[model samples]
Target: MSETADSLIEVLREQCLIQGQNGIKGLSVVFRAMDIDYSKRIVYEELKIALEKFGLLMSENYLRTLFNALDLNDSGGIDFCEFMHKLRPSLKQCRIDVINEAFEKLDVNKDEAIMIDDLQVIYSTNAKQHPKFISGEWTEEQVLRNFLDSIDTPGNPDGKVTREEFMNYYAGVSVTVDDDSYFDLMMRACYGLPIRGS
Candidate 1:
Protein backbone atom coordinates (compact mmCIF):
# COMPACT_ATOMS: atom_id res chain seq x y z
CA MET A 1 0.00 0.00 0.00
CA SER A 2 1.02 3.58 -0.52
CA GLU A 3 2.19 5.72 2.40
CA THR A 4 -1.13 7.53 2.34
CA ALA A 5 -3.06 4.28 2.61
CA ASP A 6 -0.83 3.03 5.35
CA SER A 7 -1.26 6.29 7.24
CA LEU A 8 -5.01 6.06 6.92
CA ILE A 9 -5.09 2.53 8.20
CA GLU A 10 -2.81 3.33 11.09
CA VAL A 11 -4.83 6.34 12.18
CA LEU A 12 -8.02 4.31 12.07
CA ARG A 13 -6.43 1.64 14.18
CA GLU A 14 -5.23 4.13 16.73
CA GLN A 15 -8.56 5.92 16.89
CA CYS A 16 -10.29 2.62 17.42
CA LEU A 17 -7.94 1.78 20.23
CA ILE A 18 -8.44 5.16 21.86
CA GLN A 19 -12.03 5.97 20.94
CA GLY A 20 -13.42 2.44 20.73
CA GLN A 21 -15.26 0.71 17.89
CA ASN A 22 -18.12 3.15 17.37
CA GLY A 23 -15.84 6.13 17.50
CA ILE A 24 -13.51 4.72 14.92
CA LYS A 25 -16.38 3.61 12.75
CA GLY A 26 -17.82 7.10 12.64
CA LEU A 27 -14.44 8.60 11.83
CA SER A 28 -13.84 5.94 9.21
CA VAL A 29 -17.09 6.78 7.47
CA VAL A 30 -16.24 10.47 7.42
CA PHE A 31 -12.72 9.84 6.13
CA ARG A 32 -13.87 7.48 3.44
CA ALA A 33 -16.42 10.01 2.28
CA MET A 34 -13.80 12.75 2.25
CA ASP A 35 -11.22 10.69 0.39
CA ILE A 36 -13.11 11.32 -2.84
CA ASP A 37 -10.27 10.29 -5.11
CA TYR A 38 -9.65 7.05 -3.21
CA SER A 39 -6.04 8.18 -2.92
CA LYS A 40 -6.23 7.99 0.89
CA ARG A 41 -5.02 11.59 1.14
CA ILE A 42 -7.23 14.62 1.47
CA VAL A 43 -6.01 17.30 -0.88
CA TYR A 44 -6.67 20.93 -0.07
CA GLU A 45 -9.50 21.24 -2.54
CA GLU A 46 -11.17 18.13 -1.30
CA LEU A 47 -10.99 19.26 2.30
CA LYS A 48 -12.41 22.63 1.35
CA ILE A 49 -15.25 21.03 -0.50
CA ALA A 50 -15.90 18.61 2.33
CA LEU A 51 -15.98 21.39 4.91
CA GLU A 52 -18.38 23.36 2.77
CA LYS A 53 -20.54 20.34 2.21
CA PHE A 54 -20.63 19.84 5.96
CA GLY A 55 -21.84 23.45 6.36
CA LEU A 56 -18.57 24.69 7.82
CA LEU A 57 -18.30 27.72 5.63
CA MET A 58 -14.96 29.47 5.95
CA SER A 59 -13.15 32.24 4.12
CA GLU A 60 -10.62 31.16 1.52
CA ASN A 61 -7.78 32.85 3.36
CA TYR A 62 -8.84 31.20 6.60
CA LEU A 63 -9.08 27.89 4.80
CA ARG A 64 -5.58 28.27 3.43
CA THR A 65 -4.24 29.19 6.85
CA LEU A 66 -5.94 26.21 8.42
CA PHE A 67 -4.71 23.91 5.70
CA ASN A 68 -1.14 25.06 6.22
CA ALA A 69 -1.35 24.39 9.95
CA LEU A 70 -2.70 20.89 9.46
CA ASP A 71 -0.31 20.05 6.65
CA LEU A 72 2.55 19.52 9.12
CA ASN A 73 4.78 17.97 6.47
CA ASP A 74 4.07 20.65 3.85
CA SER A 75 3.15 17.78 1.59
CA GLY A 76 0.37 19.80 -0.04
CA GLY A 77 -2.30 17.58 1.51
CA ILE A 78 -3.59 16.13 4.80
CA ASP A 79 -3.59 12.43 5.50
CA PHE A 80 -5.62 10.70 8.19
CA CYS A 81 -2.64 10.80 10.53
CA GLU A 82 -2.45 14.56 10.28
CA PHE A 83 -6.18 15.00 10.69
CA MET A 84 -6.52 12.83 13.81
CA HIS A 85 -3.42 14.27 15.43
CA LYS A 86 -4.57 17.84 15.03
CA LEU A 87 -8.02 16.97 16.34
CA ARG A 88 -6.74 15.70 19.68
CA PRO A 89 -8.44 17.13 22.78
CA SER A 90 -5.17 18.19 24.34
CA LEU A 91 -4.84 20.87 21.67
CA LYS A 92 -6.90 23.15 23.93
CA GLN A 93 -4.28 23.07 26.66
CA CYS A 94 -1.58 23.48 24.04
CA ARG A 95 -3.26 26.63 22.82
CA ILE A 96 -3.38 27.93 26.38
CA ASP A 97 0.35 27.35 26.75
CA VAL A 98 0.97 29.28 23.56
CA ILE A 99 -0.96 32.23 24.91
CA ASN A 100 1.03 32.19 28.13
CA GLU A 101 4.29 32.07 26.18
CA ALA A 102 3.23 35.07 24.13
CA PHE A 103 2.43 36.97 27.31
CA GLU A 104 5.91 36.24 28.65
CA LYS A 105 7.48 37.53 25.45
CA LEU A 106 5.51 40.73 25.73
CA ASP A 107 6.52 41.23 29.37
CA VAL A 108 10.09 42.12 28.18
CA ASN A 109 11.75 43.58 31.31
CA LYS A 110 11.68 40.32 33.29
CA ASP A 111 10.04 42.34 36.02
CA GLU A 112 7.18 39.86 36.18
CA ALA A 113 4.88 42.67 35.17
CA ILE A 114 3.51 44.20 32.01
CA MET A 115 3.58 47.95 31.93
CA ILE A 116 1.32 50.20 29.91
CA ASP A 117 4.33 51.21 27.87
CA ASP A 118 4.80 47.64 26.79
CA LEU A 119 1.16 47.36 25.79
CA GLN A 120 1.31 50.70 24.03
CA VAL A 121 4.17 49.59 21.86
CA ILE A 122 2.47 46.36 20.94
CA TYR A 123 -0.78 48.19 20.21
CA SER A 124 0.88 50.79 18.01
CA THR A 125 3.07 48.40 16.08
CA ASN A 126 0.98 45.27 15.67
CA ALA A 127 -2.60 45.76 16.83
CA LYS A 128 -3.67 47.26 13.53
CA GLN A 129 -2.61 44.19 11.61
CA HIS A 130 -3.69 41.67 14.24
CA PRO A 131 -6.70 39.62 13.16
CA LYS A 132 -8.67 40.24 16.37
CA PHE A 133 -7.90 43.96 16.48
CA ILE A 134 -8.31 44.84 12.82
CA SER A 135 -11.66 45.82 11.20
CA GLY A 136 -11.81 48.73 13.62
CA GLU A 137 -13.70 46.52 16.01
CA TRP A 138 -11.28 47.34 18.83
CA THR A 139 -9.36 50.57 18.82
CA GLU A 140 -5.88 50.62 20.34
CA GLU A 141 -7.12 52.97 23.01
CA GLN A 142 -9.89 50.54 23.96
CA VAL A 143 -7.48 47.65 24.21
CA LEU A 144 -5.07 49.58 26.42
CA ARG A 145 -7.87 50.80 28.59
CA ASN A 146 -9.30 47.34 28.99
CA PHE A 147 -5.93 45.84 29.74
CA LEU A 148 -5.21 48.43 32.40
CA ASP A 149 -8.62 48.03 33.95
CA SER A 150 -8.30 44.29 34.16
CA ILE A 151 -4.87 44.34 35.75
CA ASP A 152 -4.73 47.53 37.79
CA THR A 153 -4.68 47.13 41.57
CA PRO A 154 -5.53 49.75 44.20
CA GLY A 155 -2.05 49.54 45.71
CA ASN A 156 -0.33 49.70 42.36
CA PRO A 157 -0.94 53.33 41.50
CA ASP A 158 1.73 53.13 38.83
CA GLY A 159 -0.71 51.30 36.51
CA LYS A 160 1.21 48.15 35.77
CA VAL A 161 -0.31 44.72 35.30
CA THR A 162 1.47 42.24 37.52
CA ARG A 163 2.35 38.92 35.99
CA GLU A 164 -0.35 37.20 38.02
CA GLU A 165 -2.89 39.80 37.02
CA PHE A 166 -1.91 39.53 33.42
CA MET A 167 -2.15 35.76 33.48
CA ASN A 168 -5.53 35.87 35.19
CA TYR A 169 -6.93 38.34 32.69
CA TYR A 170 -5.42 36.48 29.79
CA ALA A 171 -6.93 33.23 30.98
CA GLY A 172 -10.32 34.83 31.53
CA VAL A 173 -10.38 36.37 28.09
CA SER A 174 -8.45 33.87 25.99
CA VAL A 175 -7.25 30.74 27.69
CA THR A 176 -9.85 29.11 29.92
CA VAL A 177 -10.32 25.54 28.72
CA ASP A 178 -13.65 25.20 30.44
CA ASP A 179 -16.31 24.53 27.81
CA ASP A 180 -13.42 24.89 25.36
CA SER A 181 -14.93 28.17 24.23
CA TYR A 182 -11.63 29.95 23.75
CA PHE A 183 -10.10 26.83 22.29
CA ASP A 184 -12.94 26.60 19.77
CA LEU A 185 -12.33 30.18 18.76
CA MET A 186 -8.63 29.52 18.27
CA MET A 187 -9.38 26.39 16.31
CA ARG A 188 -11.76 28.34 14.09
CA ALA A 189 -9.10 30.93 13.43
CA CYS A 190 -6.60 28.21 12.72
CA TYR A 191 -9.00 26.53 10.30
CA GLY A 192 -10.42 29.77 8.96
CA LEU A 193 -13.77 29.25 10.63
CA PRO A 194 -15.75 32.46 10.95
CA ILE A 195 -15.43 34.15 14.32
CA ARG A 196 -18.65 35.53 15.66
CA GLY A 197 -18.76 39.36 15.64
CA SER A 198 -15.47 39.46 13.72
Candidate 2:
Protein backbone atom coordinates (compact mmCIF):
# COMPACT_ATOMS: atom_id res chain seq x y z
CA MET A 1 0.00 0.00 0.00
CA SER A 2 1.17 3.47 -0.77
CA GLU A 3 1.75 5.95 2.01
CA THR A 4 -1.28 7.94 0.92
CA ALA A 5 -3.51 4.89 0.97
CA ASP A 6 -2.19 3.78 4.32
CA SER A 7 -2.72 7.24 5.74
CA LEU A 8 -6.25 7.36 4.35
CA ILE A 9 -7.11 4.02 5.92
CA GLU A 10 -5.71 5.12 9.25
CA VAL A 11 -7.77 8.31 9.17
CA LEU A 12 -10.96 6.41 8.35
CA ARG A 13 -10.19 3.73 10.93
CA GLU A 14 -9.65 6.25 13.71
CA GLN A 15 -12.82 8.08 12.76
CA CYS A 16 -14.89 4.89 12.74
CA LEU A 17 -13.31 3.34 15.84
CA ILE A 18 -14.27 6.22 18.09
CA GLN A 19 -17.98 5.86 17.30
CA GLY A 20 -17.86 2.12 18.12
CA GLN A 21 -20.99 0.29 16.98
CA ASN A 22 -22.52 3.46 15.63
CA GLY A 23 -19.39 3.87 13.57
CA ILE A 24 -20.09 0.57 11.83
CA LYS A 25 -23.71 1.54 11.45
CA GLY A 26 -22.82 4.87 9.91
CA LEU A 27 -20.41 3.19 7.55
CA SER A 28 -23.15 0.86 6.47
CA VAL A 29 -25.28 3.84 5.54
CA VAL A 30 -22.45 5.43 3.62
CA PHE A 31 -21.75 2.16 1.81
CA ARG A 32 -25.33 1.92 0.69
CA ALA A 33 -25.20 5.47 -0.53
CA MET A 34 -22.15 4.67 -2.56
CA ASP A 35 -23.79 1.56 -3.95
CA ILE A 36 -26.08 3.60 -6.18
CA ASP A 37 -26.84 0.61 -8.36
CA TYR A 38 -27.91 -1.45 -5.37
CA SER A 39 -25.49 -4.18 -6.31
CA LYS A 40 -24.36 -4.22 -2.66
CA ARG A 41 -20.84 -3.46 -3.84
CA ILE A 42 -19.13 -0.21 -4.69
CA VAL A 43 -17.31 0.03 -7.96
CA TYR A 44 -14.40 2.39 -8.65
CA GLU A 45 -16.56 5.20 -9.94
CA GLU A 46 -18.92 4.98 -7.01
CA LEU A 47 -16.05 5.00 -4.52
CA LYS A 48 -14.51 8.04 -6.16
CA ILE A 49 -17.64 10.10 -5.81
CA ALA A 50 -18.41 8.89 -2.30
CA LEU A 51 -14.96 9.85 -1.05
CA GLU A 52 -15.42 13.34 -2.45
CA LYS A 53 -18.75 13.60 -0.70
CA PHE A 54 -16.92 12.93 2.56
CA GLY A 55 -14.36 15.63 1.71
CA LEU A 56 -11.63 13.07 1.14
CA LEU A 57 -11.01 14.37 -2.34
CA MET A 58 -8.06 12.62 -3.95
CA SER A 59 -6.35 12.49 -7.28
CA GLU A 60 -7.46 9.71 -9.60
CA ASN A 61 -4.25 7.79 -8.97
CA TYR A 62 -4.69 8.06 -5.21
CA LEU A 63 -8.29 6.92 -5.41
CA ARG A 64 -7.37 3.94 -7.55
CA THR A 65 -4.61 2.96 -5.15
CA LEU A 66 -6.87 3.20 -2.16
CA PHE A 67 -9.67 1.33 -3.92
CA ASN A 68 -7.28 -1.49 -4.79
CA ALA A 69 -6.16 -1.69 -1.18
CA LEU A 70 -9.76 -1.89 0.06
CA ASP A 71 -10.74 -4.46 -2.57
CA LEU A 72 -8.92 -7.35 -0.89
CA ASN A 73 -10.38 -9.97 -3.20
CA ASP A 74 -9.62 -7.97 -6.36
CA SER A 75 -13.27 -8.40 -7.25
CA GLY A 76 -13.06 -4.96 -8.90
CA GLY A 77 -15.60 -3.69 -6.37
CA ILE A 78 -15.86 -3.45 -2.60
CA ASP A 79 -18.48 -5.51 -0.81
CA PHE A 80 -19.90 -4.50 2.55
CA CYS A 81 -18.06 -7.26 4.42
CA GLU A 82 -14.71 -6.34 2.95
CA PHE A 83 -15.33 -2.63 3.44
CA MET A 84 -16.43 -3.09 7.07
CA HIS A 85 -13.67 -5.48 8.12
CA LYS A 86 -11.15 -3.07 6.70
CA LEU A 87 -12.36 -0.13 8.77
CA ARG A 88 -13.72 -1.80 11.92
CA PRO A 89 -11.48 -2.92 14.75
CA SER A 90 -10.37 -6.49 14.29
CA LEU A 91 -11.39 -9.23 16.75
CA LYS A 92 -8.97 -11.60 18.49
CA GLN A 93 -8.65 -15.18 17.30
CA CYS A 94 -10.51 -16.42 20.36
CA ARG A 95 -13.33 -13.98 19.67
CA ILE A 96 -13.48 -15.04 16.03
CA ASP A 97 -13.42 -18.75 16.98
CA VAL A 98 -16.36 -18.35 19.34
CA ILE A 99 -18.22 -16.39 16.68
CA ASN A 100 -17.57 -19.17 14.19
CA GLU A 101 -18.88 -21.68 16.70
CA ALA A 102 -22.11 -19.74 17.05
CA PHE A 103 -22.42 -19.56 13.26
CA GLU A 104 -21.91 -23.29 12.96
CA LYS A 105 -24.66 -23.89 15.46
CA LEU A 106 -27.03 -21.74 13.44
CA ASP A 107 -25.89 -23.31 10.19
CA VAL A 108 -27.51 -26.63 11.12
CA ASN A 109 -27.42 -27.96 7.57
CA LYS A 110 -23.81 -26.92 7.09
CA ASP A 111 -24.89 -25.34 3.81
CA GLU A 112 -22.95 -22.11 4.48
CA ALA A 113 -26.24 -20.19 4.31
CA ILE A 114 -28.63 -19.92 7.21
CA MET A 115 -31.95 -20.05 5.43
CA ILE A 116 -35.47 -20.14 6.90
CA ASP A 117 -35.54 -23.93 7.02
CA ASP A 118 -32.42 -24.14 9.14
CA LEU A 119 -33.85 -21.47 11.40
CA GLN A 120 -37.19 -23.23 11.64
CA VAL A 121 -35.60 -26.39 12.97
CA ILE A 122 -33.11 -24.62 15.19
CA TYR A 123 -35.09 -21.66 16.47
CA SER A 124 -38.77 -22.41 15.83
CA THR A 125 -39.77 -23.30 19.36
CA ASN A 126 -38.03 -20.34 20.92
CA ALA A 127 -39.16 -18.00 18.17
CA LYS A 128 -42.79 -18.73 18.79
CA GLN A 129 -42.52 -17.30 22.25
CA HIS A 130 -40.95 -14.09 21.00
CA PRO A 131 -42.82 -10.93 21.98
CA LYS A 132 -43.79 -10.13 18.39
CA PHE A 133 -45.16 -13.60 17.81
CA ILE A 134 -46.97 -13.67 21.12
CA SER A 135 -48.44 -10.24 20.55
CA GLY A 136 -49.70 -11.30 17.11
CA GLU A 137 -47.72 -8.64 15.26
CA TRP A 138 -45.95 -11.38 13.30
CA THR A 139 -46.36 -15.05 12.72
CA GLU A 140 -43.80 -17.59 13.92
CA GLU A 141 -42.40 -17.78 10.42
CA GLN A 142 -42.28 -14.00 10.19
CA VAL A 143 -40.28 -13.90 13.38
CA LEU A 144 -37.72 -16.29 12.00
CA ARG A 145 -37.62 -14.45 8.69
CA ASN A 146 -37.14 -11.13 10.45
CA PHE A 147 -34.18 -12.49 12.38
CA LEU A 148 -32.56 -13.76 9.19
CA ASP A 149 -33.27 -10.46 7.43
CA SER A 150 -31.55 -8.53 10.17
CA ILE A 151 -28.35 -10.51 9.65
CA ASP A 152 -28.46 -10.51 5.89
CA THR A 153 -26.57 -7.86 3.96
CA PRO A 154 -28.31 -4.54 3.40
CA GLY A 155 -30.78 -4.41 0.48
CA ASN A 156 -30.00 -8.05 -0.25
CA PRO A 157 -32.04 -9.88 2.31
CA ASP A 158 -32.48 -12.97 0.20
CA GLY A 159 -33.40 -14.95 3.31
CA LYS A 160 -29.94 -16.45 3.47
CA VAL A 161 -27.39 -15.62 6.14
CA THR A 162 -24.01 -16.30 4.66
CA ARG A 163 -21.01 -16.84 6.94
CA GLU A 164 -19.64 -13.49 5.90
CA GLU A 165 -22.97 -11.88 6.75
CA PHE A 166 -22.99 -13.59 10.16
CA MET A 167 -19.44 -12.51 10.82
CA ASN A 168 -20.24 -8.94 9.86
CA TYR A 169 -23.21 -8.84 12.24
CA TYR A 170 -21.06 -10.02 15.14
CA ALA A 171 -18.29 -7.75 14.08
CA GLY A 172 -20.64 -4.84 14.75
CA VAL A 173 -21.44 -6.24 18.19
CA SER A 174 -17.79 -6.97 18.89
CA VAL A 175 -16.96 -3.31 18.42
CA THR A 176 -18.91 -2.27 21.53
CA VAL A 177 -17.30 -5.00 23.64
CA ASP A 178 -13.69 -4.63 24.73
CA ASP A 179 -13.31 -7.81 26.74
CA ASP A 180 -12.73 -11.07 24.89
CA SER A 181 -14.12 -13.23 27.68
CA TYR A 182 -17.31 -11.21 27.87
CA PHE A 183 -17.78 -11.46 24.12
CA ASP A 184 -17.20 -15.22 24.28
CA LEU A 185 -19.74 -15.58 27.06
CA MET A 186 -22.27 -13.44 25.22
CA MET A 187 -21.93 -15.51 22.07
CA ARG A 188 -22.21 -18.78 23.97
CA ALA A 189 -25.26 -17.65 25.90
CA CYS A 190 -27.03 -16.11 22.95
CA TYR A 191 -26.43 -19.13 20.74
CA GLY A 192 -27.17 -21.72 23.44
CA LEU A 193 -23.77 -23.26 22.86
CA PRO A 194 -22.04 -25.17 25.66
CA ILE A 195 -19.93 -23.04 27.91
CA ARG A 196 -16.21 -23.64 27.70
CA GLY A 197 -14.49 -25.53 30.52
CA SER A 198 -17.90 -26.43 31.93
RMSD of each: 19.4, 2.9
Q: Write the per-residue lDDT of candidate 2 for residues 1-198, one digit (tens) a residue.
A: 678777777777666657666555566666788887778789999888776665467778877887898998899999877887777667789988998998898899999989999999888988998999999999989999999988776555788988877887787789888788899999998889999999
Backbone atom clashes (below 3 Å) for every candidate: 0, 0
- Kindly list the per-residue Cα lDDT of model 1 for residues 41-73, writing each as its tens digit: 787887777666544566786667667766778
C-alpha lDDT (0 to 100) for residue 48 of candidate 2: 84
Off by over 4 Å in 1: 1-28, 91-198
lDDT of 1: 0.56
Record all residue pairs in model 1 with backbone atoms less than 3 Å apart, i.e. clashing.
none
- What TM-score, computed on C-alpha atoms, does each candidate reach? 0.33, 0.82
Best by TM-score: 2
